[model samples]
Target: MDHLIEFWPILKRLIKYAIPWKKKIILAFCLLISGATSEVLGPILISYFINNILSKHKFYFQSTLIIIAIFIILQILAVFFNYFQSIYFNKIAVRVINKLRNDVMNSAIKQPIYQFDSQPIGQIISKVTNDTEVIKELYDTVAPTLFRSITLIIIILFAMFTLEWHMAIIAIFIIPLVIVIMSIYQYYSTPLLRNVRYYLANINNKFNETINGMNVIQQFRQQNRFKKSIQNSSQLHYLARMRILKLDGFLLRPLLSLISALVLCSFIFSFSYFKNEVFEVGILYAFITYLGRLNEPLISITIQQSILQQAIVAGERIFSLIDSKKQEYGRNKKRFKTGKINIKNLSFSYSENQKNILNNINIDIPSKSFVAFVGHTGSGKSTLANLLMGYYPIKHGEIYLDDKPINSISHCVLRKNILIVQQDPIILADTFFSNIALGRKISEDEIWKILKIVNLFSLVKSMPKGLYSILGEEGNTLSVGQKQLLSIARILVKNPKILILDEATANIDSGTEKLIQKTLSFIKKNTTLIVIAHRLSTIVDADLIIVLDKGNIVEFGKHEKLLKIKGCYSKMYNFQLSKY
Candidate 1:
């Protein structure tokens, strides 16, 4: 019982989302009560009119017409209130759901990359799509219907008790029994509903994963494997729904009907056993009417229990996400004057218990200097660049920008000055110019200028609509080289001071590599460039080359000097040249 009462607070919080529409709720409630009251009065008035005025002992024509008119009016009024109740309740449900969905999506957006890396994209999408829909059904289907049924039940009880306590005693006697049944069913079904929500999230995650990797599946001819995985997720969802079906199938309609029939029989037996108890005919008729209708609310509540529980479970997930700590942002707003980077005793890891990906690293990158980091796989080259980009927190290092600690700068300010170009770039589904500018208010000429810098002007000019040509998802219409150049053009348009190229040429052909190298050479004179390269030949003229081995810088100098040192850089340089 205590645990059941605990759900009240969660429910109240869900209701808080509806507070903005309090007026509509208030009016809807009033209308519901009015409709219920009018509905219950019908049986009472019919019994009264039949016994007092329409009886053979007292035939009154005008009064009969008046009573009939009043009955019709009450039924008509009930219809009116019922119609508007649905209208306002629907409006409230839609608007409240709209607000909640927007908040969940916005929260997901503000969350840090670690959150996304930890949780699957499909699960997050399920929260925004599936969970919100559950809450909507709660308010739209379960809530309003439950409210009206409960109101009518209350009115019927009051009418029965007012007529005769004897019959009312029987009605109230079955209440505790029904409560126990519903409570037991709810207790078992809540966790099942929770599991249903869980399985749904998994199914969505699997669907998203399969769709996103469809090309890989097809290429490897592993469609059967992916198909089975999807089927398994969907099967788990089906099994969970089956448990709910068992619960509702047993408790909702069949049990309520049985209980209502039992009550009706008990009333009939009580009246029959007390034959000389002087039960009034009119009051007896009313008792039968109330007894026949007593279980409607109970039935409705039992059936909608699954919906209520689903909403509650879904609410838990949705609110858990919304209430999660957002990505940390500093208050400092200082912008970088120069792109110089200084690291003192820097050591970093993706996680605390994990080994440091960059261990005790120290380096100085002067502004407007061309620098390159060359290392074999697991050598921490990309990790160092990411740390410089502020993607991860510095655990054992103090990084300085110009002269101040890097943490002293706000994220917005820091990101405004730095940009990272990776082997795989995000290409939004939009026009060429929009993809390049990306919310920057630069003109067409400026876009063309940056494109020319990246050597993509001719490519865009050859397109059907030039800058206005819509790119497919992931810019699929463009070759890998063209996509990469388009991404670089975007960076040039932003004109950030510090640029990190993290294996940007790893996937492109030699011709594209030369094209990108030319663009790099053109831009190296003005910006701080840190290139993490596998192709050592391209960076032979870098102002400085830092060679990392197992998270430590083993060699640092210009290419010719590093060759003389015959260290890690020398071996890596030799290996690449031999491959060529």
Candidate 2:
């Protein structure tokens, strides 16, 4: 019952995406009808050849040859129309799949930071890649096949009844019996197929995780353990596939038996009735031919039911992902030119029962001022940064930029003005210049200037292919410090007003850190810079340092002032000095 209910939404969405290609679908259906009619003519033509030309010794070679030629032409035309139909249908299916994939990706990316933190990367990838492919198969294979089967059954049965009433009655009875048997098999086996799909997804998820964490596995010398995990997942997938195969065998045996029985009985009954009649032997041959034709369409429907059921399951999963809530655009707020940020009584928690990650955190950052957040591990420093960027919602209170609630501002405006340079830079496997440009159309001069500002001009000039050098996967060939420099250059090219550095210098060497520090000092006067750092030495020269402990501010003042107080900030400073 639940599965049936789930299917409705998928059906609705399929129709929604398919609306644009309705004309093509209609043409495809027309082509299917023509093909079906051509098939129906084959048996009738055989009956004419057997009864009129061969049996009564009254033969017209010209007319017989013409009929044969016309039938052949119709068959050729049918194949041509089917080919065109497949082309249009596949094109539409690809478009719908692409649209669905894009929508799901956009929604997942826009989800709250907490959602991203809690979800596994592999599960999300499974939804976007494997699940979407299953939906595509539904359109490419199941939908058209099922529709064509219906057309063939209808046209064949109509022709059967016109040729002989008694045999037609037997067919009506036997066909319904086959349908009943198929329906029973479908009802009992759908749940198993659904399980097969889930297991397949689980296997894919496990494979993706193992491949992504291959480096960690090797570093920890846990290759045996990782291999065992993959082996277990593969065995489970094999068992699930075998279960489906078992059900298929069970259904096929009984279906074949039923079809064989029906054919034998029809042949015996037809021979008894026409044994002594003046009818041409060719007519009886054609009748037998038509009987064989009728059985094939019914067999096709029986066999394809399993595929249709699997498709329904796949469609349900895909539609569930598509129907998920989209991230709110927040377009109603008024725009402001100033860069003031106000957090008022803000509280946020990832879950309802958990303690707030940020509790009543109220602060104001004036326009064009450099502010830094200093905290220990698990002190909610990153949470605060995410909130300021509107990556997640605050459960209580609100955040404002220039006195306008941040929630009301459009995402486009926020993203255009605010940018974050993460600790681990995201390097696409692409050319050096393309990675730095990152989809923005910037002039060559602008690119060179940003590269120079980040002190990467010397490196680029020394390379054999300057800006065109290809970076290996995730920029693996680039040194850590070099990747950091490239990240800075990428950000500088964007020219954002609000710049965020979340421990951006943590992975680089001390010399690279000093260079980045000098660059930050140079850019601080122009941009609203918010730096989240654990190393007290990094933010010592900042205009203001806000110290956080357990989601609350323990101290907020100039670095020198906070040190003089000998509080949390002083203790952290003293610890760092001791380490040095």
Candidate 3:
């Protein structure tokens, strides 16, 4: 009862998904009740025949045949009703799970960037796939079985009362005993099931991380380490399941069967001693038959407790994800007029407890200007760019795009105006046209023009199908330089107001770097270019360069002005020059 109270909200949310199919669910239940009625009537008809016909020493052949035929038909109707009920219930279950899986995925994609930073990708995947699948089992099997078992119990109790009220009262006591057993199981098993789910999610996270970093692991000979890690996670999951199994072995069927036997003995002994009427063989037979039949549903209810607990755990996980706060966006429809950006006293940390990744700093970027930010690793270069793109909420200070607060802008306007190309750009396994256009209906001629602008025209012309040819998974068919150039083409096609290149030229060969440089020179006239520079030579011609150290802006000027000052920017440039 306590566990039900604690999880009532989650259970209510799961029921809402089924509310849309209420009519079908109602029809299924009607079928279930009809079947249970037919099943209960069978025993009563036989008891009447035994008492009035055989025991009275008067057997009518035609009457007995009719009774036997009616009994057979009742049993057949029960089977038929059960079959159709199962069909309807299963159909509803499949549809509910499909909608739930889609909703989980949609919520996942809309989560804030920081959410992903805190939650592993694999754990999210487990919630969508593994956890939801368990929930489906709840609807498909556990729910229906419990409902059928309960309907049978109720109808059988009614039948027992009609025959003999004394025994009926004794039979009803099984319900409270069953409820007590279920409550005990819930108290002990809920925490264990939760641990099992947590370990399962951890195992999935470990596998995902290992697979993504397989090359690194092999190079460092860390295979054994990862294997042990996964083995430990699996062992924990196994132990939790084993503990539940031990609980089930002690508490579920065997215990319920014992209660059934004890109840039957007390019922028989009381009927013989307390009643003043003479012994009737038919009454004894009917009472014993009803009591024996009652045990089946009682045992079934106990057996379903484990599945119910699992479903509740899975539901809690899925609902927590679905109910988490999505990325907040305002409804302001104002569009960017000049693409100018101003940052005033801006400071940010990923979380409250940590020190700021970008300290109190200030800068203004003019429209259509070529600007560069240079810093060593962890100097908050990418963090600033992330802030500008509105990835994280600004708490300490303000950021304005085109003189309007960035947060006040609507999601559509913000995304359409400001775009960033990361150091490692994501390339899907798709055609050249699809990758570049990104589901937009750009003409082939326009795509060809952008391709030529990025100097990828020759490579596409060499392909068998040109624009329609598939890029292998993660664009494995293309070199890293080619992938980087392709990503640049993707941005240019959109013609965003602001374009950020975060170390885009870091790993590419010099030839590709030179091509990117040339491409940047072409687009700098119209697009506001913000480059997080890796090769300082690539940004020597910028209108301004800002140098950062420990999240503070230590120097800012043009190339010659900064060089004459011989500050952080000059030292970084000379260091790269010396290395080359």
Candidate 4:
């Protein structure tokens, strides 16, 4: 009730996630009603047994037996209703949460490439795992318990007024006092619990950062600093909990019990002053029984209020992710017949305030021609390659694939035709065969043939499990060069019409470079090959060498032709030659 108006929209958004389980929710509500009816009748049946048997001093055997049987029947009915309620609610809770988790993950996976570059992996993962788990209480326990508690309170209040209005007046009058206590408790505790959730996410993000960068942390001896950061985050989370603990220790349970005592003492005072026959001790007993029952739900509602606070915070985070922009794919599904790529006055930068990484560039790469983009570091060679792969939207200039705008081509068609092999391989923690084929229907024979083309067949064939051996999470078993070769084998299996090797061999040794160079020579025969390289010697045989400096291409021609001009390319070539 603290922010009920603002909370309603979030509640409504969360409810939509449960729409598919509406029938189950309705059935669970029916069971809850039945259970609450049984709960209310408990006080009534006990009242009747005490009033009739004790007050009249005449116990009819049949009447006493009937009351006993009704008591047993109420209890048995309660057990059945509770059983079905738990069954239906729990089942639907898990299903709804599973769907929500899936939607969050799918949204994360399909975000724009730049999102992964800018957003922390830990932050994204915390929203999916930690925040979603907190929101889960909306279904798992809080929703059903909140429903049953409110229904039982209503039933109990109804019975109290009907049986003895005088005592009921005293009991009901204290509810506003209890509501005030709750509102006060909520006022302080909401922000505390919210801080708790926030710090929990901070811990998640920090811990994730710590584990992922453990190598860097150790290499630079920054472990102590990272430890301090994690400890600070954990301490903040602990402080938030201590505040909630202070509130819970003194405010809620004790205050509600005090009100409960007041309700009971007021009943005793009325009994002492009023006429003896006018007040049946049985009614007083039943009223006390209902008062005791009232105590738990009141405290529970307070607890549920705190849970609602957490859920609101978690829901906002979750829906924010679901509402974030997803990667766009064009509607057209046209396929490129050849590998011809054209660029006209291409220029781009990551942000508006930043300088362009590629500037006023123009080039034409014919089908199946070998083109190398050679530049010093920060000259935008790799950025241009990423743009050509349709990794970013064409903002500053036009890129055409067979005379059609790149955005007009379908992602499926584009991905099927173009591939990029990065400098570092991304090996899954699975078998080599699975890594290469990755759930495709390529045959074992065809896979072996492709591996042979990359000169890895004999190496794989001599292993213990051959292609079936599981790779480590980082592919620690394979050398850098071997990993690059395996990545190329993946491209060969797909056999894209175009391949861009973005510094794919920059990290390998010279001995391994010859092997990769041989593989590239074989690949250049069939596809339009583009190489973004730091090493000068690797691209000397390139049909066209494009040299860039400060986002502008300063030279473009055959390697020997550029060398003859004694420009930036020749200087870089001479620098590398002196180093070797």
Q: How do all models score by TM-score?
A: 0.94, 0.92, 0.95, 0.94
What's the lDDT of the predicted structure labeled candidate 1? 0.85
User: How do the residues 300-403 of candidate 3 rate in per-residue lDDT, one tens digit apiece?
Assistant: 88878888788889999988898899988777888778879899999998888999888888999999999999999999999999988888899999998889
Best first by TM-score, ranked: 3, 4, 1, 2
Error of 1 at 29 (Å): 1.9
State which candidate has the highest lDDT. 3
Report how far residue 410 has shifted in candidate 1, in Å: 1.7
Give candidate 4's error at residue 111 in angstroms. Answer: 0.6
Candidate 4 residue lDDT tens string, 1-580: 5466657898898989889889889989999989888877977888887887868788789988888898889989988998899888888878888888999999998888888888877778888888788788878778888898889889888999899888888888767887888778767776787788778888988998898789999999999999999999999999999988888877778888888998889989998989977778889888989999887788788777777778887887788888999877676687778889999999999988998999999999999999999988899998999898887887888998767788888888888888999998798889989989978888889989988888889889988998898988778788898899999999888678889999998999998799888888888888999999899899998989999998999899998999999999999999989999
Model 4 misplaced regions, further than 4 Å: 1-6, 59-62, 174-191, 247-251
Give the Cα error of residue 299 in candidate 4, in Å: 1.7
Please give, for residues 337-388, the per-residue lDDT of candidate 2 as tens digits. Answer: 7667788998888778999887788898987788899888889888888887
| lDDT of prediction 4 | 0.87
lDDT by residue (1-580, candidate 1, tens digit) is 6547746777887889999999989999899899888888988988887668655479788888888899999999999998988888999999999999999999998887667778999999999999999999887888888898788778898998888888898888767877788788878888888889999999999989988898999999999998999899889899989989988889778887888888889877877787634566677788888776677777777778778888888888999999998866566787777889888999887887898788898899899898999899999998887777776667687888766677677788878888999889889889999998889899999998898888888888998999999999888898888888988998888667789999998889999999999998887777899899988877898999999999998889998999998887888778878888
**Candidate 2: which pairs clash?**
50-282, 51-282, 51-283
Q: Evaluate all candidate structures by whole-model CA lDDT and list the values in order.
A: 0.85, 0.77, 0.89, 0.87
* RMSD (CA, angstroms), candidate 4: 2.3
| Clash count of each predicted structure | 0, 3, 0, 0
